[model samples]
Target: MSRLPHRASRRQFLKLGLGAGAVLGLAAAGPDILAFASDVSDFIRGPAVPDVAPTQLSEHVWMIWSKDGFPTPENQGMMSNITFVVSEKGVVMLDPGGSVQIGEMALRMIRTVTDKPVVAIFNSHYHGDHWLGNHAFEDAYGKELPIYAHPLSKREIEGVQGSMWHSMMERWTNQATAGTRIVAPNRTVEHGAELDFGDVTLRVHHYGPAHTPGDIAIQVVEDELTHVGDVAMDRRIANMDDGTYVGTFRFYDELEKNASSRIWVPGHGHPSDQVLAWNRELFEGIYGNCLKAVEDGSTMEEAREMVLADPRVAGKAADTAGFESNIGKYVSIAYLEAEREAF
Candidate 1:
């Protein structure tokens, strides 16, 4: 893997969403609920369930645990990966995983870190698993927390939220519709921004035009901890259908080359330095085969079939629900690069 250069053009990438029926709601457990909160807060073991709501991740940071976890199978995907960063000036959270219960617990944990109040939050991208928790935050902290995102992030997430809610409403009888809404980013950032917390500085890199138009990674600059969002998925396969491949791969390559930090956290999986390579390889294989199928005069449908012909990629595609959505992204991006001779 190599470090990425500046983006060549505007691009938006969205990681696949949890099937509407597979979604979970945040814990709405009454404040008096005890039992698990102490265990979760204590961090006594392996992925605590029946949690105390919020689990600590770093000194002033915590990971919100939905009692049922993410809606996806094994129920431990990105939706369970929500983490909150608290500082004296204010608190900043990244990827507030699905479930209002989890969101509220996250808020409770933020209280543990500091009494300054939550000042803001940012979504890694528009995936419902990441931003659906916004409603909980707003209800608890109000909508003025200055939700920040890329300009396109709001539109993409909102659209998905509605569509996903409808999908869930159709399946689980609105189990997925409760917290769904088109929450927008009040503050839009371009390129990068630096946020300070007493002596700690979180370096935010808007690395999208790959993961999503508004995709960004937050790094604990002093700690050398970089949260890569979905871009550098630590172990899971990278999603490329939202019209990002070349730029993502290129940017990923550049990131590999330029990033010297340690402890890379992903939107979903466990953290790792190898995430850069693992993600790049997966991206390379899928995008490569997708291009080949297209070049062979295959229709998008046929191209998708061709993708299934390759066992490695076929396995990757299995977790994703939208075939055309995936293939179309490759087609559109390839068409544009050829049009501009970006290669």
Candidate 2:
């Protein structure tokens, strides 16, 4: 991989760039300084950070997935999958990881495949885990890269929602997210928009509010590959804290109409048709059970228990860790949405 020009050494990073004032401020913060320093060093050097290698899904498309675990220093907040497409013009990245370090790792992986500069980044939604890595691109290239997201996503990342997410990320990573900053997408993409990157063209589609209000799936026209963000988690029950259950099922129905023989890359987990089918079934079952529970006057807890006990959910939830909790949360959200719709 080609290294960035004028890469600073550790001493130079502290003495020349960061200086004594920043160092003293960090030192005064106590143990947090250690995590902060580690983050800084990773950002500066971008050395061989250990992460999953890119998987070639098609001739022009490659995907790098983070392990299905909570963010930690070891993973550098790589809790989402990143897909990049190589075109004659430059590289187009989709959903670039969670933090600055993770974004750096994604850049390193992209370089391993092609030396083309990243010309554009498309964030799938408003989730911090997907786009906070925008900072890394700016850090590496010494300029702001063009980032695109749905209009609602742009609003969310620029409002209180983005601030709350940033605070949560800092706490979750224990300050390993020190250099990560919220660089919201500068441009807003609408449904049915086509982005041409010379050789490769991406058709952006947002059926409705499924994963998040601004969830946009990017389909590489030549490859027949769709990067469907958290709208479709391959094998696990995706968190619904920011999404609606009914909208997810609708998105799945829309996907099925065109998903035949197409390669689908999820926001997390590996790509597979069977995984997509499983998620559709899971969403359908959750929606049905939530509606039933509401009609039966069941409490949110009751609805959660009932949904978890269902064969379709229980069987799939057992395959992945942390899904039981995710499903539990989803049931609660679903029940609330169902109640609101009933009125």
Best by lDDT: 2
Question: Where is model 1 more than 4 Å wrong at Cα?
Answer: 1-61, 64-80, 109-116, 158-182, 257-259, 292-343
Candidate 1, 154-245: lDDT as tens digits: 66655765456334422342232333334556777665578778866777676548876567777777666677777766444445556477
Model 2 alpha-carbon miss at residue 341, Å: 2.5
Worst 10 residues of 2 by lDDT: 15-24
* For model 1, the run of ten residues with the poorest summed lDDT: 8-17
> Residue 208: error of model 1 in Å?
4.0
Write down the TM-score of every candidate: 0.65, 0.83
Deviating ranges (above 4 Å) for candidate 2? 1-48, 142-144, 258-261
Compared with the true structure, model 1 gives a TM-score of 0.65
lDDT of 2 at 140: 76
Task: Tell me the whole-model lDDT of each prediction, alpha carbons only.
Answer: 0.57, 0.77
